[model samples]
Target: MTLRIATAGKGGVGKTTFTAMMTRALVEKGARPALVVDADPNANLNYYLGVKYDATVSDLRESLKRDQPPSGMSKPDFTALKISEILSENDGYDLLAMGRPEGPGCYCFVNEVLRAAMTRLASKYAVLLVDNEAGLEHLSRRTTDDVDNLFIVSDSSIVALRAAARIKLLSASLELKVKNISLVLNRIKSDAEREAAISSARDIVGKDTQIAAVIPEIAEIGGMLSSGSNVFLLKDFPREILEPLVSPHET
Candidate 1:
């Protein structure tokens, strides 16, 4: 099964971490190769994945906007070259970084082409995980709609629920082709906290969607920030949570 998962939510809510961890786990579970599109402008996924790319989608878009690469290359040729250069392969998955523009206003054409190319590329992999910007590019509608599973990651804060509700509405307005709009409540400390987090998410989803997983707050994860050692081996947490979210479809 080809599952495209889009992880989106407020900034600092562990969206990137969730995306990276889930992708890694899927790889270990004997799934076919997976692809990750780090569409967030911050582009921190690269640092976490420990892969250095030569160019980004933004770099390519800038090349098109600027009308030439630094070496005066054509857009199509530059596109093929940059697409290969920016895709980093490691740990049985490849990461494509959608970088922040070095300078720009909008990336209309490049974004369309990149999305199209990705849609075609999606058929080749077992999964495509997208880590998107936080309402920055208005990309949620397009990115999340095509996914097989779209998780709205949130913290345990009250603000998180409210923001999530808004994001859900925004997603609806964008008319995204969401297969399953699931919520992932992250960073809970205690059982009580976990319950509260799940409850909060339930309220936000409000009779339509459901909480897929509640990830416990792990101190070690914070410590691994600079190392890029994702939660592939997060035995207690990742598997505990993700197995349920995806288990039914596994068989």
Candidate 2:
């Protein structure tokens, strides 16, 4: 079964960073056939995964809007052809960028097709990790909910914790849903500081929200994110967080 892990938090909470690293960690631990869905319109997960994106779902949406048909072809056939051309993959995992956002009331036929294809694509993977947007609009609109472990990451601020709480509540209300929601306190300094965020998050999220792990507030770790590379590959960080995620049998 595919383990669907998702990250949710306001922008700059390091959701993208966590998503990339967790994927890398799983891969490094001999987890193959993983998939990472860069669902945010910001589209920065590629940087973390070291992926150079060549196309996006928006490009396909544009093609569908054009609806260009060959001399004798029908519109339906033309649409099918465009859908077949959009999917792409790199070495470690298949990456899909949702691209920049659309207006409030944009047409969505092509988007629906892409969502359907993405669903089928996800089914073929061993693990699927989604880097969510600040408000989790994709999870609501695209029916991409039901994560086995949904991580709500945040920085030092209590405001972020509040936002995570709100997101957890919003996700629960959605008919499309996350099965298990958790939190990862990011950019934590001393053990005491981490303990504070954990305690605050736990208080807000209550018993259902698991504290998955804490990402240290290390200067070099921040530097790695600056260049858009994953720090989870570092021996020490993975040992602290990712290794514990593996089941005993899987080890």
Candidate 3:
């Protein structure tokens, strides 16, 4: 079974960094060949994962409007083939980026094709980690629905917590098939802040949601992000912060 894990948070809240760390943790735990989907329009998950991608699903969709596949090939087959070509394969995982959102034109047909292709590709992996946008448009589109675990990340700020609460509410309103939804309080500065953030999160996100992980604010991670360094290079990468998120998927 593919363990579908998604990370959602407002911009600048460290969701991408968390996704990268979680990917490393999953690989270290023997979860090989995971599928990492960059569901954000401003795609950078590949950079954090230390991989480069030339194309994206949205890029293919746009091209399909103007170009045609080889002679005698159907559109669906062509789309699937293009999507497969864009997948950036790596040692422990592969990255698929969903580039910029749709433009003025209708994309119902292309979206359906992309969704189907993504579903087919996901089945070949043991884990699927999606780094989603702030609004979670990917989930709303059903591009990556039926999530096994949804991690709503937030910094130690009231505004960020409010955003997290809204994301949780939106997930419920959309009726997304998420088996477990948790709040990941990230980049905490101190024990007091972590405690306060957890308490505030519990109150805001409600008791139904679990406080899955509280990650401390590590200067090394911040430096790496600022310097565009690979996630694996961060010494003492907080694997403990990800254990809670990874253990459940372990066999």
Clashing pairs for model 1 are 145-177
Q: Worst 10-residue stretch by lDDT in candidate 2?
A: 242-251
Deviation in angstroms for 18 in model 2? 0.3
Which lDDT tens digits does candidate 3 get at residues 108-215? 654575467447777888888888877656666776567788888899888888888888887888888888888888999998998898888888778776888888
Mind giving the per-residue lDDT tens digits that candidate 2 earns over 19-132? 877777777776666777777766888877776767777676666676669889977567655644554566657777767656665526534644554465567777877787
TM-score of structure candidate 2: 0.82
Model 3 lDDT on a 0 to 1 scale: 0.80
TM-score of each: 0.84, 0.82, 0.89
- Candidate that would win on lDDT: 3
Backbone clash count, each prediction separately: 1, 1, 0
Ranking by TM-score: 3, 1, 2
Of 1 and 2, the candidate ahead on TM-score is 1
- Cα RMSD, each candidate: 3.7, 3.7, 2.5
lDDT of 2: 0.69
TM-score of 1: 0.84
The 10-residue segment of model 3 with minimum total lDDT is 105-114
Best-matching candidate per TM-score? 3
Write the number of the candidate with greater lDDT, choosing between 1 and 2: 1
- Name the better of 2 and 3 by TM-score: 3
lDDT of 1 by residue, 85-177 (tens): 667887778888876644476656546655754677666778778887775354442645576777888888978777777878777777777
